[model samples]
Target: MEVYVELTYCMNGILFIMTYEMISLLLNINWSFLKILFLSFLSNISIVLIYIDYLPYISFLYWIVLFLFIFKKQFFLYFPVFLIVYFSILFFINTLIKESFIYNGILITPINYKDIVIVVMTCVFLIIETIYLIYAKRKIKPKDDLYDVTLIFNNKIYHLSGFLDSGNHANYLGYPLIFIKKSKIDTYQQLDTLIIDGLKKRKIDIILVDQVLVNKQSLRNVYIGVLDELDYDCLLNKELMGGII
Candidate 1:
């Protein structure tokens, strides 16, 4: 079977870049796509050189040099860790593709399907790696501004996703205000209209809540109020900000 050299090179370039991104995610090192792509493109040159020389173990040497040059600040041990993840997936996928062909009584030697095999294998592994990374992120504590919370008001329990509002420093005579979406609670005007008016006029409220639970911490006597428009189900009060931030 005749192999298309240029097509193979381009395919390898793309696959290498995708594999690099997966490795970077696994290592918890954030790298921009363009930076990884540029580095991967440069790395593919080693593949061309290896292909020309038909050399074994040359790819490893080239990657070591590239990692050292580009990631001088990172721990050197992570280079081999990344390579192990990248090549293990690549090898498993390529092996499975070859086995599929053989099991079907297809003669691999007579077929010019190497490029197709490489692309398909890379895509499969990339998808698997990405899904795993997403799952891991969900299991880990989120690093964003929002967090899950439980609120107890008038002996009734409610679960909510709370967004931290640094601008919402509104307190009711020293009681922190936790703003809930108006539509979420069935009862309207739970607190006196005078308190609502006081809130709008002076950023103070007469309404108070039993408890607020967030990030394993419980807060007492927080003011619960409702807003017509809010991005989250609940807005965490500034007084209780110490628990999360």
Candidate 2:
């Protein structure tokens, strides 16, 4: 019984890791493998509830809460994919590969052909997702100067793809300026307006966000310049590579 419980825990951990990776790929979220492994470890801890009298009920609820906490508003998107992959695996094992047995939502069979099903399914999904990710990245990110940026403002997080441009030397009183689409930050009500001289003088909305991450490097209290039109979601300042201007 103890060995069966341990096997179930191990299997559940692997499933959780693969499921999380699938969702990340589908959403194009850049999460490190170590982060996924850590989350999976935390999620596997919920399997301990299986030993209780309530069995799967409380255990499942605990899992949902963990998912909600981790994914936040994105939980809705993640949950459906999780359900589909999880149930599909179970269905395939139960109907097609009936060599092993599942007792009380736990795989009790010794390591055998049943384990291969999980590996094969994981490989298939990962390969498809990898191909899609490669194609999408190539389509969206045509240049090597593109970067992944994260911004925190108004207590919200925004992920954006940024293009590096050396010509963007715009600065305000020694602070570097990065341009983003107006639609992205226009919804915020508390932005300070600024006038800058260009081909013609124009007013632009500016806000000092809580933080900005350019290629994962932290820039605290960074000023974001909102523009009416931009080809990329963000225009990265060349000076940002060195430090704040």
- lDDT, each prediction: 0.63, 0.70
TM-scores for all predictions: 0.44, 0.51
- For model 2, the stretches where C-alpha displacement exceeds 4 angstroms are 1-3, 93-99, 102-108, 111-142, 145-245
Mind sharing the TM-score for model 1? 0.44
What's model 1's lDDT at 72?
62
lDDT of 2 by residue, 124-226 (tens): 7656765665576568655887888888988898899888888989886698888888776537753678876653355778778888887657988887888
Single out the weakest 10-residue window by summed lDDT for candidate 2: 102-111
Clashing pairs in model 1, backbone N/Cα/C closer than 3 A: none
For lDDT, the strongest prediction is 2
The per-residue C-alpha lDDT of model 1 at residue 144 equals 83
Candidate 2 TM-score to native:
0.51
* Candidate maximizing TM-score: 2
